[model samples]
Target: MTDPALSELTPEQAQMAARVRRMMLIAGLTTGLGIAAVFVAIGYRLFRSEGSAPAADVTATLPRGARIVSTGIAGDRLLVTLEVGGATEIRAFDARSLKPAGRLRFAAEP
Candidate 1:
């Protein structure tokens, strides 16, 4: 008996081969999409996560060597103390307006 491997295929056999080729193409595309999805997930995990500290919507950073020593509220008054250059300065502000009223400066040490 002759082998069938190298023989010319019939019409039905050719159609089956075409169908198999289409199925393999679809499978290849689906696998490629899945791999891309995995890569996206890994990228999101590696580069898009929250860092150590939460982000601030607004920030006001005082200059170096200046420290906010205290804060107080009296009725409609706001008081804040800034200690800088070995001196403590007291500042008064209008609480409602959030504007400076007056400040008393203390002499700094030599």
Candidate 2:
């Protein structure tokens, strides 16, 4: 038996073929758009800068006889508890820049 030509197809078959082609075209377009969106998102993530790069090494100077008691991180700040002489102190530094944010000192009442 010979294969039927496009012109020889029944009306219903031609309509079904046309509908299939349209569906395929829509599916291809949606797939292409999804791939393009993924690529764009990846590119944006790679190229966008959130903030300045952190320093490689940071050095913090302390007063004479000052010793570190403990260290911790709170949100974007670095907290360091220190014992200086006979008093206790807490210092906060920016986690990214390593710059001093604030300081709190505790001393006994006279």
Candidate 3:
């Protein structure tokens, strides 16, 4: 209480110092909160995805040069029809094992 000279400052200087301190505190808090929010969001996504991907049951393979026209699935089977050099090839596949089960086709006439 007795250090009067050090405590004394011009009114304008005192006001400016108060404003600068407040600005610094507000800026620091804004930066800190922004960084904390980003970390929280990233952590949430990381923790939540552990159980998300489903196990798929089957796949299909076609000869490389075939151009697939359409594909569909019925019950446990996959039906695919494709064309190559003006010939249409159709095949059904077992959905679980992905092996060819049957074939049906109608070729384009020359």
Candidate 2: residue 66 lDDT (0-100): 96
Candidate 2: give the clashing pairs: none
Model 1 per-residue lDDT tens digits across residues 58-99: 333455898999999977778888987778887787665666
TM-score of 3: 0.46
Better model by TM-score, 1 or 3? 3
Taken over the whole model, the C-alpha lDDT of each candidate is 0.80, 0.93, 0.84
Worst 10 residues of 3 by lDDT: 50-59
Tell me each candidate's TM-score: 0.41, 0.56, 0.46
Report each candidate's C-alpha RMSD, comma-separated, in the order given.
14.9, 4.6, 8.7
| Clash counts for the predictions, in order | 0, 0, 0
Give the candidates in order of lDDT, highest first: 2, 3, 1
Model 3 lDDT per residue over 1-110, tens place: 57989889899999999999999999999999999999999999999765633556665666778899999998989889898666888899877667789998787667
- In model 3, where do residues sit more than 4 Å from their true spots? 1-3, 51-110
Which predicted model would earn the best TM-score?
A: 2
lDDT of 3: 0.84
Off by over 4 Å in 2: 1-6, 50-55, 62-92, 101-110
For model 2, how does the per-residue alpha-carbon lDDT over 1-110 read when each residue is reduced to its tens digit? 66566449888998999999999999999999999999999999888957677565988999999999999999999999999998999999988888999999998998
Which stretches of candidate 1 lie above 4 Å from their native place?
Answer: 1-6, 54-110
